[model samples]
Target: MRTYVVGSGVTKVDRHYERNYLSLINEAVNKALADSGLDISDIEYLVVSSAFTDSILNQVDPSTYIAQNLGFRKTRALTVSSGEVSGAVALDYAHALIRSGKARKVLVVGFEKMSEYPSWIINRVYSKILEHEIEGIKNVSPPEYAAMIMQEYVRRYGVSREDIVKWSIKMHENAVKNPYAQLQFNISLDLLNRALRISEPITMLDSHPIGDGAAALLVTDESITKKMNGALIEVVDIESSVNLPIYLRDDITYFSSTAAAYKKISSKNEIRLDKTVAVNVYDTYDIYGLLIIEALEICGRGEALKCLDEMPYLNIGGGLKARGHPVGATPLYQVHELRELMSGSSWVKYDGEISLAHSMSGPDNNAWLILLRRWV
Candidate 1:
């Protein structure tokens, strides 16, 4: 049976000083159940996105604890972790369960709590995702990885600082309308260039915020979805590709996994990039955003900036750049953005026909792309 996402929910991306990880999950799951009109007992599977465990916070075994606390004792529970794309991986498992006749309905929840720890602790955790031996031993962060990617892109295409800065401006502009976005405020070209640089070509404003948030979605197939009204989306296709690490790849500027996945997708389906209502590429940094546009070949490799005027819905929910990447929960947030954009829950009424949510991990070596056709 074809799967459909019938319900979705996302907590505001910000520092929840009072809420713990369990509280955040409860808030998002309850909202999703209420919206989908599904009782807690109706859910047969629970897939939780698990990323990091903070020693300072005394957290452990998130999936087991969360399922029990949410009163999902009898339901089969599993956890999926792929660095920052935990949510996407979890969604894939949930989709397979029903497609395999394991369960008719499943609930996928992704959440992360980063504010409880110090900056250095967060850095150590993020560094390990890329390459534990090198990055973790040397204490290298994710932004530093993006910096190397940006510098290489500049050398290859002669991309100027001005060209790269425009991408950040576009992301910020899109975030202003998304209330769930952590950094909704806009920034000008001057501010972007002058802003403190973390890794050359990327500034503080260019990266996604560090915040705590959770998102949940209800997954079922098209057959059962017909009984419900119109609030559902069809998962037309799901594809994934894995490439060698950045150090092993021929070109660090290009993401081979994205290319391979899209190449396979294009042969089977007609992907009208121009017709897509929302395209959520993993935008770890502004330069990462350009590489995303270029990798998909949505527009010309170096011409991503020129198409910004027309790609207003590029990151309807500000993407990871402004919407805040709670790491594990981010892909789920992208799914939420698609639902809101089609349901008229977005800041403005989106006249969109199709939306695609894509996420990459380990510096774009691995990718997961999900195509959604609007049923509203």
Candidate 2:
């Protein structure tokens, strides 16, 4: 499919959801329309993404409700729930529909209001995303599972606790400059050094906080992009991996789904991931980020450190740790952030090449990758 991102937008990611879930989505959708210089009527299709909103915020079928609120009563809209990967999945669906000639312009919006519930209740909601047999009955929190993976990753990669803390410090430092970031605290290495330790090596600083936010993207056909003089950013390739039960997996160090999806994208497209100008990887936790980096084969088995020194593009937009991971909105925010960097609106500069965004889930635990470029 020849899908190009015409425009994108995001509301400041924070817990200030004085508005309802649908209202948040409409605000973001309107922003995307304004950014693209298009009206709400211009969107032929719309996809909505959220995970805990319906359960915690009491807003089920947000797509229909949001579309009506945005004056998209006549347009087709569907809700997508895929844990944290819902945003990426929604993008994939829009791209496919456009490429298949089923739609012309699609509006994709992702949102979540996690602050609606208390922290402990929110933790319970996330735990439901895990397999019941392996994690549900055990009442293993998401951070607990992540901590288990962190233990394995540390053993395999020889990554020290200090290395992860350094990453957190850098992320928060970057977040201070991002006005939209929820955790704008400019933390130093020393603070992260002593930040409350949650699970052995995994500390409270290492995990993404429960924030509220919304993000939107306008994807159009290649022809429509030129006709509208759209700020073209090509969706070069999109791939998704199947869900895997954590306990059934062969190795925690290697995410089979991520590896498979990366391989598929590599074989089908001319994506030079290593040379990409910028990258946004799913980073709900430091360990998860490390796992994805390794699984994508961006570096050698135990060479994340070496890769880090070479690749500064990894999560420069502050990632989930710094940018505030608002669940469903995280990936969409990544796409928007990458678009800004590619369009030279960001502080960083590149040769006008490719940028990538990766998103994952915890329940089905699906993982997805979206590769983009300024020019094909």
Candidate 3:
């Protein structure tokens, strides 16, 4: 059995002050269903991915709540929460169900609502995603970790800070054309230099913004593809791995989990990195984006900045830096954007058959790599 993504949809990545969780989910799911020309009744399973429903929304069993609200009377619903990688985890579940002969059609919805709370409260919740008892209590946040990694990368690689700033400028420029992106305006190196410092060597401009958003993907077996006229993007392979916490790791600049997952996928699939036209990486911070490129072996270690200009296909959707990292919903957005780009429906034009999406939890404590091929 083979799994194919028949359709996908995403809501604008922004502070949805007027929309609630159910409303956002409904909008994304409905758009996906409409794109596939399949009704909600056609879906056999519902996989919901979220990270803060319990802590922020005070809602328990959010999958059940979403099922009940969405009129999924017979469809089995499951929830997946793996910090920031929840979306990719949920997608893995959906793929398994179809490939294992359990279901013909599966709907994966990833969402996060974070703008309703204050920055202090949101920051506290974000810290909980780390090794809570250890790193959480130390007052070290994600930005600080990113700063440590960035500083070390510069020291060891001899990459200039100006080169890193170019990544942000490129992302913002790409986002300017992406209607769903949160930060859709162009940025300048001078402006970034003047931006407020979040940590040493990391300014607010380099970090992804917190916002509310949702994305949905409809995964179905090959049998269902015959009946649908929409573009089909095959789920070539999905691989994931876990590593020790950043504190336990020997190198702060390397992402072992991401490397492990990439290696697994490479062994199973004959994917050519040079031929892959688009790659969506977990760019919660600029340094993480650069690190992912090296970890995936797209470029040699510490060579990302040097090879940055050579890799023009990276983060065409603006990445999390400008597209907005709504935590659990982010991976789904990557998948959705790749689907659009591969199908030639996106603002950015790329004529390629393969695309890769990368997502991670914390500073690469856990990471997932999804390979997608455009079906001709």
Residues 16-95, candidate 1: write the lDDT tens digits: 88999889999999989988888888888889985775433566557788887889978888777777778888998888
lDDT of 3 by residue, 68-174 (tens): 99899898998999899999999999999999999999999999999989988998898778887788888878888899889899999998876898888889988
Worst 10 residues of 3 by lDDT: 270-279
Query: lDDT value for candidate 2?
Result: 0.79
Q: How high is each candidate's TM-score?
A: 0.94, 0.94, 0.97
Which residue runs does candidate 2 get wrong by more than 4 Å?
none
Task: Please give the range of 10 consecutive residues that has the lowest summed lDDT in model 1.
Answer: 52-61
- Lowest-sum lDDT 10-residue window in model 2: 270-279
As for candidate 3, its clashing pairs are none
C-alpha root-mean-square deviation, candidate 3: 1.3
Candidate 3's C-alpha lDDT?
A: 0.89
Please provide, for model 2 over 253-325, each residue's C-alpha lDDT reduced to its tens digit, 9 standing for 90 to 100: 6777877888888788865567244778877887777677777878767666556656667787788998988
lDDT of 3 at 54: 87
